[model samples]
Target chain A: MTTWDGAAAAERVAIISDQDVVRVRQLVRTLAVAVKLSLVDQTKIVTAASELARNTLVYGGGGNAEVSRVDNGRKPGIRIVFADEGPGIPDLDLALTDGYTTGGGMGLGLSGARRLVDEFEIDTEVGKGTTISVTKWCR
Target chain B: MERVPVLKIGDILLVSIQIDMEDQVALQLQEDLADKIVVTGCHGVIIDISALDIVDSFVGRTLATIASVSKVLDADTVVVGMRPAVAITLVELGLSLPGIRTALNVELGMKLLAQEREQYELDLEDEDEEPAVSTR
Candidate 1:
């Protein structure tokens, strides 16, 4: 439904709804400066962002994308979490592998996101929902 | 907290898009980019799609359009981070773009920008020098 910076933190952005992929990317564009993400990295993040948003819209029926800054004392990074309450991926392992998509895309949404970021994680329950987290560090 | 949140940097001016070597969206992106460059004066543009699982004719045409438009706008363009499988698919499909600048990764695309900028500056200097020489 909307994309806004965190309620309490300026660095965080919460995107709600199936149509918020563009909004999430817009948020990323705004934060690119502080994050120092390269032009290519930005595209990678946006592409994955768009894919995830679409997945929620098409498959999950709706969901939210949450983004925030991450710090581990040494490096600063961007963290994005996508949550959807759809049917969930039936095969987690096959779904993560490239060239194995049931959807119309290149089947690289999850894999591509993994490749683009420094860290990637996914959790799903067949009947419950799915949550994916990805992070890219800024040096 | 009532703090006004403003985008700190300049509209995140630079963005490189990597589309499947053959996607119709790529062409639309070209038109979209042309308009942005005309209005915003952005510097970075990278289009890398190494994980493209498919490449069709429409996608091919779109890629060509994006390359051509970006060049006309004097924007730096780089086709980087292409997946080998995708590349093979494109080649097998015989899809090719005439003038899209290409590199292996986003890093290479950034390097290309440096070179392109230097060339642009030198061309401007040449134009400036020519006017002075003609006066004498």
Candidate 2:
């Protein structure tokens, strides 16, 4: 488990399976309310969490997503990490590219998740697993 | 630390959106589903916005695409449980959906789709009965 300890404002939560997406989303909702993220920031985080959890279900072969609060000195933010032991991305570059979906419709999971966060990162190994980290700070 | 849970009920595609939706994500959804909606073949789409506090042009665009794509896929699209504040924000942003249907709940959306399908079939029948005009 990659653990992060930031300001006291941070609250950490974990998602272990597809069933956890709703739980994680609900936690984020409460935190968003507590922090009072701007309309745009709130939407961004909520959508980001939803997309990331969807990724966990579709690509991760079911994994865990951890949610927490990040205080960036200037503003408070939300963070999410989606990790899976399923077949790791064989081609990270290609996976991030738009219109390159192996699943239904176009591939927007990773890219869309990136867009919803103030900061985003991904770590993966083929045949091993993958982890996606996202942070959204209020403007 | 906890895991997020998700439940998929057929092709309904239920998701709890964030309060603030981003521009790039919205555009991605629009482009991704641009050629996929069909109004006569699909069951319908349900987007849950109960967690959201605001809606932006990007989100509005994505939702609109879902609606448009559902038509192309012969499916119907509906946005469920929108917050009042978010609605006002969308209106203020001048965000509007095109060629899409919406409902306050999932049941209503399904019903709407059923009605639309019946109407579409009737329209098709009417067209079939009309005399064909040949350019030749």
Candidate 3:
């Protein structure tokens, strides 16, 4: 359904601390700009990456984020995958709902991140792990 | 942790964020602002964020908290210089930042604070002019 440019085009950043969240935003911005996304689109993806990256650290107990260029035959896009081996989300539906959060956050991280990107996919298993992938296509 | 400097200009505190703020840094700024408000007894705070690339939920929430804290300390807070792209993304993320005042730039923000200070002084004067009637 989706294709990437190559393995070499991907960059991985560790999401272990608060500083890592800032790193994630920077990485996403660089990749988004390289793909020639609009300025607004670049901001959107960077913000979404920051949210997801923080989720990985605070909720997932640390993780890794992979950023790469994607292609869907029509145009080039940016795709980011955040993978974590910590406790997975028990309630996917509740987690996706706005204003619902186990953490003390505003509960807008997951839902807001989803809204900022064009494609969002989540894979999780209770007590196992969680992986969230999002893509933003150039317009 | 790196700290954001808060400069005092007259009765207003100015903070121009010039770094990619981490969570700890944001929290530190909040605490620092509260302390500075008490020590300096400033009437207004203007936070400049034009240099920030993105304002996520964490940053947005922090700004709102700072505004509330400043209000409780009897000071008005005005966030200024949000990039157009950041504003669009913030709206899309469903963070309207209610109860927090915003301005296009520092000059406008300063103007707003000055007007608020004037109105506050007028209200105090009116209260002082009120005749007190106490029943013995």
Candidate 4:
């Protein structure tokens, strides 16, 4: 099991509007670069954050994203958690399936975000909300 | 709402996306491009995305929509200057950006647009020369 050390840096950005999504992307990119991730990895994580952030805003009806720089015993990584108090995902499997979307999107947000990050976790309830945590470690 | 500017050079409309655009902004740019295509009577549209660090699904879809919209307006659209890293990430994200033509840089994209225009003119001339020749 991988255990993360305390975050060296952290920030939260609201995902309530379209511009907030862009801000989330910028925040993730800054943290990814600070973590010393490769260019491709940085791009991947930032893109994933953009997708998830949009999901928070569009489908979740509004949310927040927390970006953090963390370290395991040997390597540094960036982790982002997106949380929203909107309609929870009814079907986790279907939500993770590519081309499956309830929000009129391309259905690539969840699945594509999973492919981009090294670690992914989701917590949700039917009436409560959804929180997705994704991490990309330096290699 | 910040707007992406569209500049006209010769018969082509050039759009260099310099901002980290919001979703609404992306859609707005698509509408603006469609209008510009008709107003300028351009034959081609070149969208330069070199400044963009990442092209997520929304932006990718927007670009494809812009390409298809331009096609309906009788203009070819070429997306140019995608960074190597962005390309790798976009492919991994399962977005191949279908229906949108791409080039390495603006210069090459311009060349492609010119070639496409020349080919179109040639095809038109061929049709005019032999009206009975089957277009199939």
Native-to-model Cα distance after best TM-score fit, residue B3 in candidate 2, in Å: 23
| The 10-residue segment with the lowest total lDDT in model 1 chain A | A1-10
DockQ of each: 0.04, 0.10, 0.81, 0.85
Q: Which run of 10 residues does model 3 chain B get worst, by summed lDDT?
A: B127-136
Docking class of 2: incorrect
Q: Could you tell me how far off, in angstroms, the CA of residue B76 lies in candidate 1 after the best superposition? A: 23
Q: What DockQ class does candidate 1 belong to? A: incorrect
List model 3 lDDT by residue over B1-136, tens digit each.
8999999999999999999999999999999999999999998999999999899999999999999999999999999999999999999999999999999999999999988987787666657675434334
Instruction: Identify the superior model by lDDT, candidate 2 or candidate 4.
Output: 4
lDDT of 2 at A46: 68
For B1-136, candidate 1 gives per-residue lDDT tens digits of 0111111124223444432221224544656667776777765466655555333333445566666776677666667776665555344333454577778876777788777876676677867465433322
TM-score between candidate 2 and the true structure: 0.55
In model 2, the number of clashes is: 39
Model 4, position B80: C-alpha lDDT score: 100
* Docking quality tier of model 3: high
Give lDDT tens digits, candidate 4, residues B19-63: 999889999999999999999999999999999988999999999
User: For each candidate, what is the lDDT?
Assistant: 0.59, 0.63, 0.93, 0.91
* RMSD of candidates 1 onward, in order: 12.9, 10.5, 5.3, 4.5
Give a tens-digit lDDT track for model 4, residues A1-139.
1222366668888888887988888888877777789999999999999999988888888999999888898999999999999989889998999999887888999999999999999998878889999999999
Instruction: Give RMSD (Å) of candidate 4 vs. truth.
Output: 4.5
Candidate scoring better on DockQ of 1 and 3: 3
Give the true-structure RMSD of model 2. Answer: 10.5
